[model samples]
Target: MKLSSIIFIWGMLLCSSLNLFAQQTDFKNFETRESTLDERWELTSESSQGTFVVVPYKPIYILPGRWSNRPNKLPTSLNPDNVAKIPNDYNNFEARFQLSIKTKITSGLLFGKGDIWLGFTQTANWQVFNEKLSRPFRELNYEPEVIFNYPLPSDASIFGLKPKMVGLALNHQSNGKSLPYSRSWNRVVFHAAFEYRDLSFTIRPWIRFSEKFDTDDNPQIGNYIGVGDATFVYTHKEQVFSLLVRSNMRLNNRFKGYADFTWSYPIKGNLKAILQVTHGYGETLIDYNYKQTTVGLGVSLIEWL
Candidate 1:
């Protein structure tokens, strides 16, 4: 069965398990509520009698190529002044999960909204430049994110403002034992999102800032200043289309750009799936041109509490 179908079954099982636990409770003061836990999300409603969660699995393909810079055809060390070099066949694979969690608060807060997740990401880059090694570069990361949403009254839009939300994320990466120069990196990112919604349309814009630090530099490649990244997400729900453009600026004067297009469709109930293609380009370690492209199919586990 497909990943989505499997997740639905797992969620049902979890709900049933929670119900059994509730019935076995001896204290009358304690109440049993439904809870959900999956690869995508684990959620529980405050007044709910049980839990409901969903897990989504994604199989993705990534193609990172330097069409203008070939590893074998060019000099061992690239010379930026020379423009006649061929491109390289650098490709990679990525498995990604987008997850979330939501629970109603019993006290203090009036509004209810949960967290967002970038989920689990594993990327492997096949280096055409060095074919003799066991591998080129492999990385795995699990980064769960949290988002807080605060809705503003309609009159707030008159001042060119809309509902605002904030998000925070922590990402930790582990470079497998392949390249001798393997090093780990940790990053903390903060985001602020704003949304404008009317009866017929919705527009959302968000900005993110991040800082990365090196953990163990076994090879002793000194660390540099932090980096900054920002993105703009535009969506037209009526047309089932979304556009995402992201740019990262480094203190060392290097920058990366990402452009993506997505088409989405409803799969079952509140769940939706999206197919996307992302094109990226940036500066390599030697300042040579670096390019990457990826095509992926993703499932969005959606809910409104």
Candidate 2:
């Protein structure tokens, strides 16, 4: 009864059971970016017939995370020197959704050259478990973008980099505040993605659109969130791992680097257990400069989306 032998047997059994369940999967309810991009998106009760749907943004999950942050609350003012203000709760339940208003437009109008999509993802940080203030949602960030994904040729190379897919997006991210706490930015993002076997890498660089305001909101916000982010995705069958890194390059990245790591494993059909770890900053719009480390566990409907 060697320990290694028992573990091996258990692993084998788990794989076999997962495979059996997968073969019996309906797949009609599975939501993933890959499946959606391939025109195999999940169907909702309000879905239109055929590949196109009214709401193109796929529903991600019912619950996203239950997290505990190291530096929980942040200063009410967006000042680096100010200490965190109180009257809040930490270690809360979080929920996220990705939705889109479909324009019914695609690359077909480009003479079948590529695929174009308009989508938006909104992330909300909620203190659901706290009864102190009726469990208020702390922050909400909206990201809307128009993406055009161009399939890259196998032999394509730009600046000694081989890109699997190239896309340009007109992106706008904002917290939708009137003043005092208004944090928003507009960008023209360019992304190049590369894939090697089970590993995927996406390089996203953005140029910020100039604003005509007299003064900037959260002037030093870029030092915490950075101008660009690179994501690494690794998948092994039912298990998925993703890491995202963002650093301010202008200051030689003297700022604390931001990193997010997520590991997801299938739990049931269209559901997977998610363990997410984030460090540095930019967990929420209001707390962009508040650095903290957080670990969370929850369920995810789409791991790679």
Model 2, residue pairs in steric clash: none
User: Using alpha carbons, what is the TM-score of model 2?
Assistant: 0.72
CA shift of 77, model 2, Å: 6.0
Which regions of candidate 1 fall more than 4 Å away from where they truly are? 1-139, 145-155, 158-160, 167-183, 198-226, 230-239, 250-254, 267-273, 281-290, 297-305
Error of 2 at 60 (Å): 2.8
The true-versus-predicted C-alpha distance at residue 66 of model 1, in Å, is: 17
Per-model TM against the reference: 0.44, 0.72
lDDT of 2 by residue, 14-71 (tens): 4564445446443444443342222322212132233233343422332345555553
lDDT of each: 0.36, 0.60
Best by lDDT: 2
Stretch of 10 with least lDDT, candidate 1: 30-39
Each candidate's root-mean-square deviation in Å?
A: 11.4, 10.1
